[model samples]
Target: MRDLDALDRRLIELLSREPRIGVLECSRRLGVARGTVQARLDRLQARGVIRGFGPDIDPAALGYTVTAFATLEIRQGRGRDVRAHLARIPEVLEMHTITGAGDMLCRIVARSNSDLQRVIDRVVDFDGIVRTSTVIALENPIPYRVLPLVTQDGKGLATPRDAARPQGEG
Candidate 1:
């Protein structure tokens, strides 16, 4: 990933606060030329720094209220096949190859505790999956975010475009 400068950070912050705002509106708010904003957005996208501009969805709001993390123990030399099988399951939201007692960890969701058991059964039913231990999430006091990373100061470094940003925009 390219090192984000002050201008990039501010642009991200502004867009995150108002995702529906247009590039021209962003240019006006940031006090930079429209082309500058357009160029920066293009560069950021090309560099894969900006993934996508899509609506964030809450699974719980969509009838999946129960959330659990499952740690799986796999049979030797079956990681690839197991991961492929897991990819087909929509309830498997995220997966990571982990160290320690488990070979992989998966974040899963379901409608209820009983529903979670069914999900778990489907996960372990696959060949090469030995065992799984799961922990139900009671609540989430802090959700996932990347804003602090975007807004971090890079030891006083600022891009030329940062000069055009309004005071307190940082």
Candidate 2:
């Protein structure tokens, strides 16, 4: 993974703000040639910097309002089975193996508090799971974001870009 130059940062900032913008529009906004914009986008995608342009869906809008985190302890050598079991449950949004008192942590969502219990039951129903603990999220003051990180200069400051030069030159 190479470092993102000034034009790359500016291009990313522009796309993050307007994901639906076409390459021509992006080139106009970024003051670069259309081919330049397309090339940069292609390179970013090829390098796996831009994962996908999928719609950002809200679970709350889909009637899954409640969110909770579950810390699970699985039986020895049952990690694969436990992971497969959790993956079959639709409520399991994401899971990670962490270094802590628990073996795995999962982010889950449900329709309500009562529905949360059912989700948790299904999560722990597998024979591979040994113990589990869960905590309900009351509020999310700061939702997920990556724009700041994307444009930062490694010193926690947004990098400045010079638009006059050709794109991807610097």
Which structure among the candidates has the greatest TM-score?
2
lDDT of 1 by residue, 51-110 (tens): 889998899999999999999999999999999999999999999999999999999999
Report the C-alpha displacement of residue 21, candidate 1, in angstroms.
1.2
lDDT of model 1 at position 18: 89
In candidate 2, how many Å is residue 13 off? 1.5
lDDT of each: 0.87, 0.87
What would you estimate as the lDDT of candidate 1?
A: 0.87
Please list the residue runs of candidate 1 whose C-alpha ends up more than 4 Å from where it truly belongs after superposition. Answer: 155-170
C-alpha TM-scores of all predictions: 0.87, 0.88
Model 2: lDDT equals 0.87
Error of 2 at 159 (Å): 4.2
Q: How much does each candidate deviate from the true structure in C-alpha RMSD?
A: 5.1, 5.8
Q: Which parts of model 2 are misplaced by more than 4 Å?
A: 159-170
